[model samples]
Every structure is written in structure tokens, then in C-alpha cells.
Target: MTHVPIRVGIGGWTYEPWRGSFYPPKWPIKRELEYASRHVSAIEVNGTFYSSFKPATFAAWRETTPDGFVFALKASRYCVTRKVLAEAGESIARFVGQGIVELGDKLGPLLWQFAATRRFDPDDIAAFLQLLPRTHEGIALRHAVHVRHDSFLVPEFVALCRAAGVAIVYAASADYPAIGDVSGDFAYVRLEDAREDEPAGYAPAALDRWADAARTLAAGGTPDTFPCVAPGRAPAVPRDTFVFMINGAKVRAPHAAMALIERLGAEPQR
Candidate 1:
């Protein structure tokens, strides 16, 4: 079996609560990414979802992180919030053109997260997927779509993602719809139910379940997971998995990520 790489991390490095706990005390704000990169193999850049960043900023981010670290950027709101998905080509282009390629190999997946109100429209989604560039400046770009609406829980939606080679984010949360379908060559998962009471954020049993699921995904088989609306066919090849501990009980997210990494036997920096 191929040893598929699995990266575990939190949404962002800069959080007030994590200052003294997750981050070293008296650590400079500017060096947060540098420190976080040493511990977690990956990080989801949530700031990009709110605003566009300059090329220099992206370059600086790339330079700060260590080698083998991955930064998954969230697509800007303008690119995904339009009433008509077909008309979002220019917006999407502008977002992608904004020095994202500067990250180079450090760049991982580009996450396109839709609002809960955004229902599933097959034609609209297909048009938007078509607009996604397969490559950015000759570098291959991976795309992941995170649909929050329950309307997206359909076989047609899964088929569209599979055909487009876009990964559908497996977001496990009680408040939001969780879809365990694997569509693309990679698996993107966001764990949103981390509890503050639990020392590791997630219960030990829950982490074990997720670890097993990650192993199965990396080994090229879809594990029988829950909260799935439509279970799609497995991919022909094994896939690398990116798992992020996000939202609920946000303060303990880093701890949760580290626990999962340890469970996978990926040594995290102390």
C-alpha cells in the first residue's frame, strides 16, 4: 500500500485564546506562522476568505513556513457569493491571479465554501466548477468545495464534483450537513464538533474513529462513515488527506489537531 501523506491542522495560527497555550508565551505575533508550521503539517488560511491578499503577502507567507508545510487558502467571498455562479468567472480569475501562485509548492487546496443558504443548482455549480483553473501559472491547483446547505446532499452533486475532479469537503458537524463522499484524488475534512470540556477537544473514541477513517482514505478505500447524504464510488487511486480542526470550541483546535496527528503516528513538534 502506498503511504499517502496526511496533514492535520487548525484553521489559522493567530487566535487570542491560543496565545499562551498553543503558542509559546511571549512569542512574537509575526513569528506565529513560523512556530505553528513547525508543529502542524498544514494550516487553513481563513483570512483570505474575507479579503484579497497581495503577491508580496503571499510570498512572505510562503517564505515563513518550513519546507513540507502546506497552506490551504479559502477562496474569497466575492468569488463564491454571487447570485449567478456562471457570472463568477472574472471574480474567480481575479482571486486566483492575486499572487496565490506565489506560494508555489507550499500551496495546497483552494477551498470554495458556500453559505448555508446557497442551495444546490446543478447547472450553476457546473458552470462555477468549469471556471476553476486546473493550473495556476503552470502549477497544478487542487480545488475543494464546501457546501453547507442540505440541498447539496444528492447523487448528482457528488457526480458533478467527481467528474470535475474537485474534492467535496467532508464537514462533520451537528449543525451543518456532513457528507462522507469522496469525489477527487484527495480528501479534505473539517472537524467542527470539538468540545471544550474534552482535554483533546474531541473525545478519545471520536479521534480514534477519525484516525481510522483517515487511514482508510489514505489507503485508497472509503471507510463506512456517517452523516453521508450520498455515498459515491471510491477513487481508482489512494489519496492524500488534509484534516482541519475548526469552529466549535475553537481554543482547543490545535490540541485536537496534534492528537489526530499523533494517532496517525505523524510526529508533531513539541
Candidate 2:
């Protein structure tokens, strides 16, 4: 079992003015990334949706980060388009073969994010998931599926990932519907923007709730696989989870992640 502390990372983009209230006024992409990297163990790149990454970009990222730092790249829109699996099979294969494989060791999991409008079609989804390449020796990477709609948050939907050997994302948000389903061992949990006005920053209460849930899952091995979506506050590495924080205004991921590292680090060694 790996004892690495929870791996946390900020969401890809932090440049949004976001209602005119964020630091630096002008978020420098590279700088923000470097800062987050210094504190968190991994980051999820949400930029691959609109633009194709040049090999140089991946190489530059590798050059910029430390050895253990990991990157979870979102599969481009082109790869997860609404087209049928058969239609997009070649594109998927090509993207993985050309794009992700090129990332070398920095690559973590390839995230397959389904748009809100993209409803789950059992037949289509099953076929699409089946088309994804399985484990490879070159990189011990797997695919993580994130659904941005209410319909895909059910047991059946989670089961799809389990059957496919993929991880399903657990997102935390004020606007989204409740998360009642616990799908796979490797799950993804995200703690979105809370607020600085209110009791912001992964409140101790929230952490306790999550920690309790995590312990339950850990003990029973219920959600056998665990990846995480987060405010960079959730634990991942040592516990087999992944955390991504999309909320940067009220709570900086570095601050929250460092706090979490200290807390987890202080726990009695087991």
C-alpha cells in the first residue's frame, strides 16, 4: 500500500475574473500552475476540451514539474463527442496513442467528461467505454469518467464505470443535485466554490463528514477504487483517491491542501 499523502490539485483554469473578485486581477497561467504544483501533488487539465495540446506543451509541463507530480488530462471534446462509439473509436485511439501517451510519466488518468446535455445512453456508453484502451505497461494510467448532469448520478451509471474498470467522479457543488450513490472503489470527489463571505474553506464540519464517509468506504472497501474531485482538500495518494479543486476564490487550494496534509500527517501512524 502506498503511504503518499492525499494528492490534491487545483482545477485547470484559475483565470476567470469570476464576477470581478480574484487575486492578481490577471491570473498568469504558468505562474498559477507552478504555485499550485508547489503545494499539491497533481492537477487536472481541463483545457484539452477546446484546444489540442502540442507535444511541446506536455514536454514543457514535464520539465516544469517535479518527478512525482501527476497530471490528469481531460479527453478532448473531439474524443468524447456525441457521436456513436463506432464512429469515434479511431479518434479515441488516435488521441490516446498520440496525445496522452506522449505525456510519459506525468500523465495520471485520462478524464472522460460528459457534457450536461449528453445523457447516458446505456448502449452507446457501454460501447464507448469498452473501446477505451485498458491498462498498459508504458503508463499505469486508467480512464476516469466525469458526468456533469443529474441523470448520470445513479447506481446503474456508477456500475457502468465499475464494469468498465473506470473511475466515476464525485463532484461537490451547491447547485448540483445531491450525491446519494457510491459507485466504485476508485471514485472522484470535487469540492467546488463555497465562499469567503460565509464559513468558507472546506469547513471542519464538511471535512468531518467527508472523512467519516471516506473511512466507511475505506473500511468496507465499498468504493474499492477512489479518485477524487475536490477543493484540493480531499485526501487521495496514500488513500487511493484524487482531488481537484475548481474553487479558487474563497479558498486557495494550496492553503487548504497544506492544511489537509498537516492534519493527515499528524494522525497516528497506522
Cα RMSD to the true fold for all candidates? 2.1, 6.4
The per-residue C-alpha lDDT of model 2 at residue 110 equals 82
lDDT per residue (tens digit) for residues 1-270 in model 2: 224334566566355532123235555655665555655677788887667777777887877776667788888788776566546787776667655655677777788877767776777888888888874546666787777766765566666666777766666666654343444445455667545544335676655555554454444333323333221222232235566666635345444544444444422112
lDDT (C-alpha) at residue 58 in model 2 = 80
- lDDT, candidate 2, equals 0.60
Per-candidate clash tally: 0, 17
CA lDDT of every candidate: 0.88, 0.60
Model 1 residue 127 lDDT score: 85
List where candidate 2 sits over 4 angstroms from the true fold: 1-5, 13-32, 83-86, 135-137, 178-185, 198-200, 211-239, 248-251, 266-270
TM-score computed on alpha carbons, candidate 2: 0.75
Q: Model 1, 97: alpha-carbon shift in Å?
A: 0.4
The most accurate candidate by lDDT is 1
Query: Residue 6 of candidate 2: its Cα lDDT?
Result: 46
Instruction: Please give, for residues 1-270, the per-residue lDDT of candidate 1 as tens digits.
Output: 123289898998999999998998999998998988878888999999999989999999888887777889999899889899889889889999999999988889999999889999999999899899999889899999999998999988988998899999998888888888888899999999999999889999999999999888888777787455565576557788999999989999999998998899985443
